[model samples]
Target chain A: MTRLLGWILRYGIAALFVVAAVFPLAWMAVAGFKAKTEVVATPFQFFPEVWRWDNYTQLLADESFLRSLGVTFAGAVLFAALSLTVNALGAYAFARLDFAFKRILWVVVITTMFIPGIAIMLTSFVVVTQLGMLDTLAVLVIPGAASGMQVFFLRQYYLGVPVALEEAAQLDGAGPWRIFTRIFVPLSKGAFVVVGATSFLAFWNAYVWPVLTITDPELFQVQQYLATFRSDRASEMGLLMAGSTLAALPVIVLFLIFQRQIIAGVRITGLK
Target chain B: MAVTTLRAPARDTRSRGRPAGRGRRRETKAALIMLAPLLILLGIFVIWPLLHAVYISFYTWSFYEAPVFVGLENYLTVLTDQEFVDSVVRGLAFTAMVVPAQVAVAFLFANLVKSVSRKTAAVLKVTIYIPAVISEVIAAIVFSLIYAYRGGILNWFLGLLGREDTAWLGETSTALPAVAVPAIWIGMGVASLIMLAGLLDIPEAYYECASLDGAGPWTKMFKITLPLMKNIILFLLVTGFAASLQFLVLPLIMTQGGPVDSTTLPNLFIFRHFTNDLYIGYSIAAALLLFAVLGAVSALIFRLVRSEKAVDG
Candidate 1:
């Protein structure tokens, strides 16, 4: 009886998760294939009698949607690479290197985690404006370059790494950069993957800053893009759903591929 | 405990070097050099903006106008504003609702997932975590359709129970809670994963002893699991509160903080105010107010929950 109850408990929660996670995604997929009138019809149809693939076709046909997709793609890719590179370098420093204000600097960096994103948003906007980066991808990427949380997470994991590995490299006449590149970087691949996944997700889901910074429909990222398109053309529910489905696809793909590493990263980073 | 083991080798390495003191100093300086870029970046971006934001909160400025010294006016205005006050209250309530629900569900899910096969657990976690990674806009749109009155999937399912279609987003009563459900859903996967980590950290000896003493899973969880996971739980409480307080996208994209602004969270309230030039300073003031509330709550939690061991930090 106890064993049976345990099985039920596990399966029950699993079923709830399936319903919560999969159903909406499935409904969105079905909605993407839905017709205009059928979408707003009196009763919801679990499966649409007609699979309107034209919804995707029509959505793809839109110059704005296509442009926004291009904007989102370019912005996300750039944002990920820049954030990942900057964070990695910063993390390396905090992890391996000792500076004049090493303890103080790490404390200060970690302290920034307490600074709410909205608090600094106005100044960041001002900074971007002064740098003449307003309404551009530079504004999007540059302000978001320094992730304090990433630095702290990376530094914590790096603390677990043995110093002798790098010392051994130094003994073999490896320079600082070479030691970092060959030894530190290769050894911290797990941390790197976690940080990369986080940066990707952060940049991809960014909405407020993008909405404020970019006004041109052509330059909007995915969330902003969807909001603009939906608000402008609510009549095309089918097309909007299609656009939303596409917007959701990449992150889902990433989550599926990096589930274990990402979960491990969450274990480290979440507590921190 | 691990510190002694780590330091002993470093001490030995120090003794083997000629002119060890100067050599160590030189290496330390080299480490500082490699660390320069990060230090500079943090100073300029994190520290500077933080202080600047507080400074700006005291001034009256639109992007067009030079900021005028407003003294306490901005703060007073934000305090007195009806909409701002309401939104802050609503935000707090939302956090109160979402945090506990998320923590509980996450714990339950983590417990369930632990016993499953590794492959099954991976599949389950990936499935669950998909919502967390999904962009708020897409999820909002999807949920909007699900909660839509006429032809929405949820109401369609409800119709099978012979109940009339009820408006999920259309009604003021259901609007805020409607928005919060998804917030909790997105949060659950992350929370569960965090709890699972904490659960994994617990030594098997405690559980084994508890079971030998005739403790069931319930007692074991309360006595063994909960106490051991306290730090992780506290961390979740702080982070979860922050995330819930700052939630804007769902309400913004889905409800537009509508049905009489019943769902207008503080973040969305601030965002809307900033977007409209007439009330920009007021929005900043409200935002600062929110910052204070969150900071206070966090400090309170830290104070209340801190163990004797945590006092050093």
Candidate 2:
């Protein structure tokens, strides 16, 4: 009886959480194939009576959404690469190299990690306007280029890397940059992917910052355009689901591929 | 711990160098080269803006108008504005509800995931974290449909049990809690993952000993797990509070802070004041107020934690 109780206790909560997590995602995917009537039906049809593949085709037909999708994809890719490169270099300095003010610099980086960006957003907007970056992709990607949180996480990973390897490289006459690019970076692939892929997902899903900065229809991102489309076609659950399903796929697929590494990295680092 | 371990070996390498001063200079040069990009970017984008906002808070500058210095007027205006005050209160209320629910559910889920087989644990962990990977936009949209009045999923399920359709997001009283559900759902995934990391850090030998002493799972959790995971729990509480306080996406997309502004959060309130009113200084003032509060709380927590074991610089 005790064994049975333990089994039930463990599996019951696991099953409940799985259903809760997967339900909306599964519903979104399934409902994208649904007819407009079936999606909003009173009884909440468990399955679509007729699979409407055209729901996707119709959504793709929208010029603005397609443009926004392309823009957001390119922007996220760039943002991820930009932040990863800049932050990794900084992390390497903090983790591997000794220099004047090293401790002070680490303190500075750690201190700024907790400062919320939105609290200074109004003035940041002013600064962006002064630099004439408004409505440009540069504004979207550049502001987040040197995020302290990224540097902090990367530094934690770099600390665990064997210093003996860098010393061996030093004995062989490899400079910091050469050793970093050729040896340190390649060996730290797990950390890099976790940082890069997660940052990519974050940039792709970014809503408020883009909304505040970008106004050009040409440069409007996925979240911005989808929001516009949402307000415009509020009652069109079928189209909205189709759009959301399509928008959500790349990230979900990416997350699945990197699932183990991401979870393992978080556990090892033990920091957000 | 990381600082000392990372630096000690590098210093040893330097002492074995041909010339100590030159090696030191070279390292400094390399450090500067590598750190320049990040420093320049952060200075222009983050630090400078923060200081400038402090300067702007004392002035009066609507978007179209030139700035006129009026010391403390903007702060006074925000303090006296009932709507702004209410928004701050609402944001705190949301955080109070969200932080605990997230922390508790995360603690429970993490323990349950640990009890399962290795394969099941991995699968369960991934599945639970999947929602967090989904964007807030999609989450809001999906939840909105479920909460919609006519032909909505919630009402549909209710009607199957012979109940009438009720407006979920359409009513003021229900709107905040309605929005809170999605926030919690999306939030739990990350919270549980973080909690799992903490849980995994504890040794199985400790639990085995507890069980040998006649402790059940609940007793083991309270006696052994809770105390060991104190740091993790505290970290989760602080970070969770910050995230919940800054939540704007769900309410922005779902209700637009509507149904009589019942769901207007601090971030949304400041954003709408600037966007709707176009008063830049006032917005800056409101933002500074939030920054000060968060900073003070963080400093207090740091002090409390430091009194236990100091964080090395």
Candidate 3:
């Protein structure tokens, strides 16, 4: 009887978790196809009585949605590429090269993780404005182009690479830059992809920074655009759900493809 | 521990170098070249803004007029402000609710998954972790539909239970909790994975020995699992607390700290003052205070974790 009770408890809790994790997202996707009348009807409908494609069609045809989508795509790609290159180089230096004040410099970099962006945002806003980056796409990518976490994470991975490979390259008269690009970068490809995907997801999902920095509607990223679109069309639940689905699709797809690397990345960086 | 082990051998090799000075200079030049982009960006954006935040906290400037020196006046005003105090309390309350709930739920799920087969565990982990990859903004929007009043899913469930539909996010009493639901749900995936990693790290022999000694499941869990998982628990708590304290995006989009400011986190409070009221200095002061609190809490967790490790050793 006790063993039976334990089996029930185990599966029961697992069932609850699966439901909680999947239901809201599944409902949102279902609701996007829901008709306007069905969405507001009392005694809520789980699946739409009549699946409507108008929400998706209308959102696709909308100028602002298209523009914001373009901006989001470009911004995420650019931010990921720029940050990966810069952070990988910095991480390589920390992991391999000898330098003055290396320990203190690394400490300084890690300390920035403790300084929450909210604390420095006001001044960051002022600095960006002074640099004439406000209301521009550069505001979305440039300020966050170098993350302390990315550097620390990549450095940890780079440190695990065998020094004999680099030593052999040095004996063959290869320079530091050549050794890093040929040996370190290629070996740490998995870490690079992890960092790149994370950076991309971060930029894609960004809300507050974009909202605070960009005033122009055309310049808005998908998330900022979605929030404002929701507020503007608050009464239209169908269209709003559609917008949320569209905004969430890219990251969802990315996560599905790269789930293993992402999970490994979290374990490595998060634990240490 | 891994960091020290990895760093030791690298240092040993460098210490026995032949052409030490010339090699060091070349390495330094290469390092500087590689690090230039990171340093320049950090200098302009991160480091400068951090210093400027401290500097601006002591002055009253609204961008239209020249800065006027206030010298602790902004700090005093922010400290005594009732709204600021309430925001901090609400933030702490949110953190209190989120951290424990997430840790417990995550722990439960991790333990449950461990009892299953390896193939089943892998599939379960992926499904549960999917929500965490979705952005906070998207998660909040998704939950808004779930919590919607008229045709909302929650109300629909309430109808089945013969209970009256409540405005989950529209009332003061329920607003904070409602906002917290999505935060906890989205957080469960990552937290569970961390906990699962910790659980899997334990040797199978420990459980087998416990079973031979006639320990029940509960005893094995509490006496063996929990004690061994303390470090992972500490990691989850610290990161969870810090993340909760900086909660902004969900609240910003969902309620705008609405229904009489009931869900106003300190970050949101600062956001409103800086953007809407244009009280830049005041907002910076409040933000600084929030940072100090987070720092202290983090330090406490670090010390606790370190001491626990020492005792284990």
TM-scores for every predicted model: 0.90, 0.93, 0.95
Model 1 residue A172 distance off true place after TM-score fit, in angstroms = 2.4
Per-residue error at B92 for model 2, in Å?
1.8
Writing each residue's lDDT as its tens digit, candidate 2 over B152-187 gives 888998888898888898898889888888888888
| DockQ score of the complex predicted as candidate 2 | 0.52
Backbone clashes in model 2, listed as residue pairs: none
Q: Each candidate's lDDT (Cα)?
A: 0.75, 0.82, 0.83
Residue range A100-171, candidate 1, lDDT tens digits: 677877767666666777776777676777778878878777677777767766655655666667677777
Q: Which ten residues in a row have the lowest lDDT in candidate 3 chain B?
A: B1-10
> Per-residue lDDT for B60-169 in model 3, tens only?
87888888999999999998999999999999999999999999988887888899768867778888888887888888887887787877878888889998888999
Highest-scoring model, DockQ: 3
Candidate 3 TM-score to native:
0.95
Error of 2 at A74 (Å): 1.2
Clashing pairs for predicted structure model 3, backbone only: none
Error of 1 at A10 (Å): 3.0
> Pick by lDDT: which candidate is best?
3
- Please give the RMSD of candidate 1 to the true structure: 3.9
Q: Return the clash pairs for model 1, or none.
A: none
Which is the winner by TM-score between candidate 1 and candidate 2?
Answer: 2
Order of candidate numbers by lDDT, starting with the best: 3, 2, 1
